[model samples]
Target: MKTIAINQYGSAEEFKEIEMAKPQPKSDEVLVEIHAFSINPMDIAGRAGMLGSPFTDNWSFPLVLGWDFSGVVVEVGSDVEGYAKGDKVFGSASSSHSSDNGTYGEYIAVDNTELTHIPDGLTFDQAAALPIAGVTAYYGMKHNLDLQAGQKIFVAGGAGGVGLFAVQIAKAFGAYVATTSSENHRQLLEDLGVDEVIDYHKVSAVDVLHDFDAVFDTVGDVDTGLKVLKSDGKLATIATQPTEEQKHDQQKQVAFQFTYGTGADLDALAELVLNGKLKLMVETMPFSAENVIKAHQTIEGHHTTGKIVIHVKD
Candidate 1:
């Protein structure tokens, strides 16, 4: 099998392609012939030796680089009950902090418990983009903040992967949504149902907005998000914890540290997709072992409109 992996943890240049043995599923796992995998910010961090060293003994060398995947079940393990061969599915292959390697190859072994059937209407490309970012956005808004209808919710980085999904999900759940983005993404954010689009380059979130019920900061900048929260309101962020000064006026501050894809949550996300309540924003390039370096460079550039996916068909 052909796969892309890291021979060393240094820069995007360190990523290499190799011919590797394909994995067989255990009793609780299903073997998926990967159709597509999407890139995340964490992938760049890992390639840059920022997420420790996945190539070290403390971790694992030649580590697979993707966590989210969508594909068909080529073989089903005996213990898996609800799934079988030929089923279309999508989900994350590991936890957020997982050091167990991942799904950046022609195939991956996924636990049936963590996999979700792709929504009936979505394509493999769209499904591939949903698992990691979709699950994060869903759980972040629905569970972490317990956002209610009519409540004001702010989403920082609204035009990015997770932020785009967050904006749609918040609006679907009935919250008035405000988001931040660059000039090019303002119209896109509006299309996703954002009530207000804050151009980060034009005005600061602190100066232009106030009295928010909750703020979801995907940019990892904690201080800026804290400035806009209403007194005693909850604040959610994927990175950067809010400080004491930032939390001083808030009744509650909840930083959504990490969330992994689950069967139920993925199912809910799929339902939303099937019903047209949510959509996937995909930027795709060819998937090949040799192109891994180029893929990492694209993700590191941070200018993608949404998820960046690699199409792999063995």
Candidate 2:
């Protein structure tokens, strides 16, 4: 199997394509032949050696850095049920810090609990784009925010990977959604049912928006998010945590959310996709070291309109 990995963390230039032995499934795992994978902000952070502590502290050199993948199950573990060889599947990798279990390769041995079948109408690229970003948005809106129908919510960085999903999921839940993005993405987001689009470059959301039921901050701008939020509103951020002083100054509920993959959540997202409630906007790239570097650079710019996916097979 061939994998793009980093022997030492630094820049996107650190990516190198290398050959490694294929993995066999454990009793509760499945061996997947990866077809596609998507780039996320965490991949950049992992490549830059920012992922710390229990996640990557013990990971060895030549660590593979990816989490979202869609592929075909080539082999199933003895204890695994409801999945078989040749099943099309997609899911996020459960271990955040493991050198041996990343999706930036031809194969990955993943726990069965994290794997779910891709529905009939979905492609591998779209499925791969959904796991991390979709699950994060789903969990943040459904769990962290407890957003109710007819409520108002604002999403920062509405053009981002998670932000795109957040806006659609909010609309799916019947909430009146407003988000901040550049002029280029305004029409696209409006097509996805976003009620309001605020241009971040020309104006500030704090100046015009107020009294929101919830705020979903995908960018690290928690201060601006707090200013636009209602006194009793909840704010959920995946980008960064609010400082203690910031938290003390505002009595609103705030949480830093980290999403883990589960088959049930993936199934729910798949249902939304099948029902035409959720849509993915992805830019596909071929699998190569150069393209990986390019994708990292594009995502690091923090202005990408949608997910960037790498076609690993085919």
Candidate 3:
């Protein structure tokens, strides 16, 4: 099997192509032939040694550089009952308890609980973008918010991968959605049912939005959302934790998002895709060592509209 591994940290150029034996599954695991994988901010951060010695910690040198994968099952362990040979599956390969290493290879062995069967309406490219970005969106907007109809919610940075998902789910939950995007993404945001598309490049959120309900901050800097929130409103952010000063107002709640993958959550996300409610935007790249470098460059560039996926099989 072929794999991309990072020998050292720094630039994307550090990714190198290599050969390794195909991995085998344990009694509770399944072996998947990877079709596609996506790059994420955590991949960049982990590769840069910012995630606390990924080079020497739970993940060793020449680590596999991804976790989001969509693939076909080729083998299943004796303990696995939900999947079989030739089943299509996608999700984070890491188990709930184990968070290191990744799925950037021709084959991966993940616990059966860590993967989900892909529905018939989806493609590998779209499924490949769903694990981290989709779950994070679901966690923040669906799990945390006690949303009600006629209430207004602001999804900050609504043009990015997770932000796009935030916009759709907030609407699905019956909230009037407002979001921040540049002029270029105005139509797209509006098409996603946004009531107001704030041109964040021109003006700040505090200048335009005064809220009565909730705020989902994907762009970090939760203080801006705090400014416009009503005294009893709630603020949700996936980026950084709200500071003490920002949380001083007792009437407003500052919530931090810690998203994790589960089979039920991934299946619900697939249902949204099949039901024509959620569409994951992605830029597909051929899976290669060189393209891995280019994908990292795109992620760090900070202007990606959605997920950047590498088509691993075809």
Candidate 4:
């Protein structure tokens, strides 16, 4: 099998193409023939040795570093249930590192419980893009912030991967969503159902929007997030966290954490995709060595308006 890995952490420029033996599924895993995957900022963060979690902490070079995937099951574990050969599956990997396992390869052995069936009508590219960003946005709104209908909400970095999904999910739940993006992304966010769009480069979100309800901060702007919240509002940040004292003094639901991907969370993302309730704009790139390098370069620029899909195979 062929895979792309980083022998040393620095930039996506370090990705090395290597050939390795295909892995067999364990008793609780499935061998998936990967069809597609998404390029996310986390990928860059991991490649740069910036992640604080186990995903990147203490990781050595020549590591396989990918997470979200959409693929077909070629084989299944003996203990797995409700799944079989030739099942179309798509979901996020429960664990990631260089040597452990990753999605940036021709095949992957993922725990059965960690994946969900792809919706009948969705394409591989669409399914591949859903896991990381979709679930993060879904879980952030549904579980972390407990966003309610008719409430006003703000999504910082709303043009980025997770923010694109966050805006759509918030609208599906009947919330009035305000997102921060540059002028380039205004139309895109509007089409995705964002009620208000703030230009983060020119105007600070805190200065312009007096928020009620929740603020989903994909950007590292917890300080500004606190400034814009109402007394009862919550702030959920995927970036740096606030101190315990800050949370206490704010007197709101302030949480700083990453999305712990679960079966239920992945299902919610699929349900939204299957029902025509959620819409995502994606740019697909061929999964070649050249394209992979280019994808990393584009991601590093941090101005992409939607998910970047790596078309791995059929």
Candidate 5:
């Protein structure tokens, strides 16, 4: 199978197409023919060699970089159940550090527990866009922040990939939502039921917003989020880690949430999509090394309004 990978981590221009053996399912995995995948900030960070950890320090070159994918199952392991050769499945990979198992390929062998059936109304592109951002937003609001109806919450970077889903999920829970974004995205955020939209360029959220039940920080602006949060409010950040001082503060609750993809969480998100409570905004690109470079460039700008999805098969 043909796959795009980096000979070494550096620039987006380093991407190249190469031929590799098609992967087979492990005892608890399924072999998927990938149809689409989406780019995330982590992909850019990984390409820049900034995500080095003990788990990824020994990775070899020609590393495939991707996380969220939607594809059709072609083979299932003996241990897998409720999935067949023709099932339409989509989910995030459990680990993005694998050199050979990343989703930026024609085929991938993913664990069955991390895969879920794509709901009836979602397209491959939309399903591919949902895994990381959707699951992160869902888990942060539902688990970390414990957001509830009749309360107020503020989301930083409301136009971002994760922020878009956070705002909608808050609204669905009947919470009053306020967010910060550029003027260009104000109308769209309002259409998604945002009660207040602050232009981050002209004014700061700390100046006008206050007394929120929770703060969902998608930008690395935890200080601003803390300033605007009520004394008893909970704050969750996916962008950066909290300082030691901030973590030990007795007054406010702060947490750094790292999302893990699960079939159960994907099912919850699909239910929201089916009920018309969740929507995805995506820009589709053809699968190619050049387009992968272009997509990386667009996401590196840090101002993209929605997810950028690559059509891998059709």
Candidate 6:
């Protein structure tokens, strides 16, 4: 099998293509023939040595580098049930640093629990785009902040992958969403059901908005998000966190400390997609070891309005 990996952890230049033994499944795992995978900011963060997670140092060079995948099952381990050969599955795979599963390859061996069936009408690129960003938005809104309908919620960086999903998910939940994006994405955000669009570069968070039931800082700009929180409201940040001094404030701010992709969460998201309540936009590109650098560059630029996918198959 052909795989794209980072033999060294310095730059996109470090990514290389190589032939590797195809992975097999364990009793609780399924082997998937990957059709497509998406590039995310996290992938760039991991490559840049910036995301200081436990999984960071666990991976050595020549390690696969993606989490979300859409593909068909080729083999199922003996203990795995409710799934079988030729099932169209898609979900976030745990990294190689954790359990030898990552999606930036022709094939991956994943625990059955981490895989979910893609919605019938969605394409491989669309399915590949949902897991990480979709679930992150869902968890942040449904779990962390406990947002309610008619409440005002702010989403920072609302035009990016996670941000775009956050906007739609917040709307589906009946919250009045305010998102920050460039002027170019204002109409896009409006179509996604955002009540207001604040250009972060032009309008500061505190200047344009105040008093919200929840604040979802998908881009991790904590200082701006905290300014608009109502007294009892909570703020969820993926980037910069609240300091001890800020946490002691009366607004009762909360930050999202990142969560692993879960089967239950994916099912919830899939339900939304299957029911025609959720819409995801995907930009698919061919996946080859040679083009991995181009993919990384596009993600790093942070300009893509939708998920950027790489099809692993020729």
The C-alpha lDDT values of all candidates are: 0.79, 0.88, 0.83, 0.83, 0.88, 0.81
The TM-score between candidate 3 and the true structure equals 0.93
TM-score of each: 0.91, 0.94, 0.93, 0.94, 0.96, 0.93
Model 2, 99-202: lDDT tens per residue? 86788899998886567999999999989998888999999888789999999999998888899999999999999999999998899998999999999999
Q: Listing every candidate in turn, what is its Cα RMSD in Å to the true structure after a full C-alpha superposition?
A: 2.5, 1.7, 2.2, 1.8, 1.5, 2.0
* Tens-digit lDDT track of model 4 for 1-314: 88887787887788878776676778988889999998888888877887776675535656777888999999988988888989999987755433636788888888855588887788999989888888889989998888889999989888888888898999989999998888988988887879999988898887788956888888887878887888778999997777886587456788886677777787888788788778878899988767777888998987576788999988
Residue 78, candidate 4: how far off, in angstroms? 1.6
**Of 1 and 4, the candidate ranking higher by TM-score:** 4
Q: Regarding lDDT, does 1 or 3 come out ahead? A: 3
Ranking by TM-score, best first? 5, 2, 4, 6, 3, 1
Candidate 3 or 4, higher TM-score? Answer: 4
What TM-score, to 2 decimals, does candidate 2 have?
Answer: 0.94
Give the top-scoring candidate (TM-score): 5
Per-residue CA lDDT of candidate 6, range 20-97, in tens?
Answer: 778777898889999999988888888777767565656755677788899999999999988899999998876543
- Residue 71, candidate 6: alpha-carbon lDDT: 95
lDDT of 5 by residue, 85-128 (tens): 99999998755446877888898888865679998888889899
| lDDT measured at residue 7 in model 3 versus the true structure, 0 to 100 | 76
Task: Name model 5 segments beyond 4 Å from true.
Answer: 54-58
Off by over 4 Å in 4: 56-61, 97-100
Q: How much is the lDDT of residue 163 in candidate 6?
A: 83
Worst lDDT run of 10 residues, candidate 4, spans: 92-101
Which stretch of 10 consecutive residues in model 1 shows the poorest summed lDDT?
Answer: 94-103
